[model samples]
Target: MTEQQRKDYFDKVDKNINEFGYHLTNVFESKERPSFFYSTGIYKSFNLPEIFIPSLPHGLCCEIADNYVKAFKDKRVVPRNEKLQHLSGRFPIFLIDVPTSRLTDYVLSSVWYYKDGNYEYVQVIYPDTQGHFPNDAGYDYDQEILGEFRL
Candidate 1:
């Protein structure tokens, strides 16, 4: 997408988030959820399997929606779109909220492409926070952090 188109897309997504709020419950309930699913051809052609994150219900959608809004507002759509295009339809998305301090020191590569004997899958992890919480086991810094306990 061109730079302007990317910005426009981000703006559109931000408007959606602002109108709907960055609530996962709402994101999931929205009629647009079906579009997020990959086409059978996409999987078959790319050998992309259903992706799964070991973590569950970690509010990754909220983070993504929130980031889109922030990117639009900050006028950072170009870089944002570049990163997003690489991620789009690449992972099924699995997330979990563990204390950052509790997370393992392991590299924890969140996005992976895997294929084995007629099986394939891509996984991606979106952290809710972008701040420095290296001590916490699995705190996402990309989230809005609405409150101490809320992202």
Candidate 2:
């Protein structure tokens, strides 16, 4: 990213967070990793863990993230390891504590935005359309695609 692009990106992140109480950082898929999106400003505003959703389409990730943040804003805290049924229709979403080791890899932007603070965040993993998670008895997906976010 160019110097000007970097400036613009931070400015947009700050603006959105100020106006919407949170912002979504979407990372598109690359040859080495699947796509993922995460929320910034939630922890800042609500003392809630930032959210991360890996290995999903951009639009779906955004929708699920919006719901999660909105619920958090209203004080509906979803416990870690709980399945949030119907939060995304047939595909129930789940949350788990994001290992700090993977933050630099999967959530670099969030890390940068927070200035590498010891803030809390969670990985928002979910099941396939068939409702099977990456580790379920019948889950289906390659470890190469999910990397360290297959929970």
Best by TM-score: 2
Model 1 per-residue lDDT tens digits across residues 15-129: 5335543212221224522212111111233222322232224354334433433434344222310124323232322222233222122111111111132332222344333
lDDT of 2 by residue, 83-123 (tens): 77755754776777766566677766567778857667777
Report lDDT per candidate: 0.30, 0.73
Query: Which lDDT value does model 1 have at 14?
Result: 48
Where does model 1 exceed 4 Å of error?
Answer: 1-27, 30-39, 50-118, 131-151
User: Global CA lDDT of candidate 2, please?
Assistant: 0.73
Candidate 2 lands at a TM-score of 0.85
